[model samples]
Target: MIVEDSAVVRHLLAHLVSRDPRLELAAAVASAEEALAEIERVRPDVISMDIRLPGLDGLEATRRIMAEHPTPIVVIADAVEERGLRISMNALRAGALTVVEKPLGPGREGWEAVAEAICTQLFIMSQVPVIRQRGIGGMGAGPGRAASARAGVPPFSRPSMVGIAASTGGPPAIARVLGALPADFAAPILLVQHMGASFMEGFAAWLDGLVAPRVLIARDGMRPQPGQVHVAPGNRHLSLTPAGLLRVTDTPPVGGQRPAADVLFDSMARALGPRAMGILLTGMGEDGARGLVAINSAGGITLAEDETTAIVYGMPAAAVRLGGVSASLPLDGIGPRLLRAIGGTLEATGGQ
Candidate 1:
């Protein structure tokens, strides 16, 4: 299904979908109202949504659709406009699977390639199974149970930094995890979220306002302060040196992702060892699985979001299969478990 206001772009998107052998056009509508009217009737496997619409913008539309029908949605956003990018990020928070650069019509240069990429992304996203908002299930594991002799890790390990890897349904999950942390959470977070290059700047800016900690695009040679979050810049690998400074590298893409999660995790393993903590959240692939193993081998704490709460369990499942995780937890349990592994910081700071 396609929900777009522009007739020209809508027609082109429809054409793009029809032409792709891997995809099929379910419906095409000019407004969110039209989309809502048609969604239940058509029952599309996926939806291509426009962030900006005549009435009832994509963010609200996403929330309603996820609540009512629970279908996968991919937001197509204008990369040139900061506000559109912001709305796109908000749409992700509202339950859209992912956001992509809006394609101009075929008259524009490089339109064909961009359109192909968009279609491929749409098809790949369509395969992700969606569910009605369950509001963070499976909190069975708590801070008390975080320490496990069965998992082969110490009961307490003071981590100096945290590295996270996420993709597909990541934005909102990351938001929930970070928002659950206290004001003085005390770890510099290095995050690698798979997204289009154009969305990275706006993603960081939007996240900074939503979470207590400071969030910014990672920079080379920068030292991360406590409670600061550094997101890997687009098209670059974010790694840390043994000296404890961030490095944004131009090295070739690892596992087809420029700012691969493995790069960040591997670096953390080498630099911080037992003092490093890694979290593999909801995502569609195995990008961060090896990195988690690297950290586990170095005696660091590795946590993975269990399949029970993960939007998609690919990354976390991969880690579990590779023997990388010290504890497999639900989304609601991760923040508290991290705090627990810190040993005494939360009690000292008067935090829950």
Candidate 2:
């Protein structure tokens, strides 16, 4: 299903969907109101949503749909407009699966590539299994508290730095973990999230507002500071030098992902060794699995988000299957576990 206000874009998407025999055009509506009304009848496996609409905007529509009837949604956003990028991030936070930039003019150069990319994204998103919204309170302080209470003697030493990698349903998960940490957290944090180029600035800005620590896009030659979070920019791979300074490279995508989790995790394992910590969160594919193994082999603490809380279990599952995870935890528990790890209070019990 496609929910777009522009008739031309709607028709274009419909035609594109028709061309792919694997996809079915359940419905295409012009406004959010119309989409809300028609979605129940269509029961689409996935939806391509536009940010701007006549009645309710795409973000709100996405929130409502996820609350009432959970389904994977991909935001088709205008790449040039800053507001479009901002709303697209909000849509992801509201439970939409991913965002794709709207193709430029249909007849312009590179149109075929853009069209093919959109089709590919749609097909991939349709296969993802979506869960119902459990509300904000359900996400905070439950199993994590129980686990923390049972912790015995601490095994892992305090880490000098922390490296995290996520994709797909990562925005909210990142926000949840960061929000739980204090402003005075002692370890410098590095993050790599797979997102479109147009959305990077908006995502960093949005994340800054949500977390206590300073959140900024990573820059070459910058040294990460404690209590601050550095996010890899789009189209660049973020890594660390042996001197512990940040390095952004134009290296080719690893496992088809620029700013791949493997790059950052491998760098941390080599640079900080036992002094580093690696976290693999909700995402698609096995990009970070080998890096997590590297971290484990280096005697560093490696964690993967538990399958129950992960929006997509692909990345973490790969790490767990490879025997890379030192501990597998729920979303809310991860921050608390990290806090305990840094505070030297967590037990030595191996992977759960």
Q: Rate the local accuracy (lDDT) of all candidates.
A: 0.85, 0.86
**Highest lDDT, which number?**
2
lDDT of 1 by residue, 59-175 (tens): 889888988999989999988798898889888877798988888877788788779878988898889898885433323443323333243345545787899889988988898
* TM per candidate: 0.92, 0.92
- For model 2, name the residue pairs that clash: none
Off by over 4 Å in 2: 140-154, 344-352
**Shift of residue 207 alpha carbon in model 1, Å:** 0.6
lDDT of 1 at 150: 46
TM-score of 2: 0.92
Error of 1 at 283 (Å): 0.7
Q: How many backbone clashes are present in model 1?
A: 0
Model 2 agreement with the true structure over 11-113: per-residue lDDT tens digits: 9899989998878899999998998898888999999999988789999999899999899999999876777777887788789988887876578877887
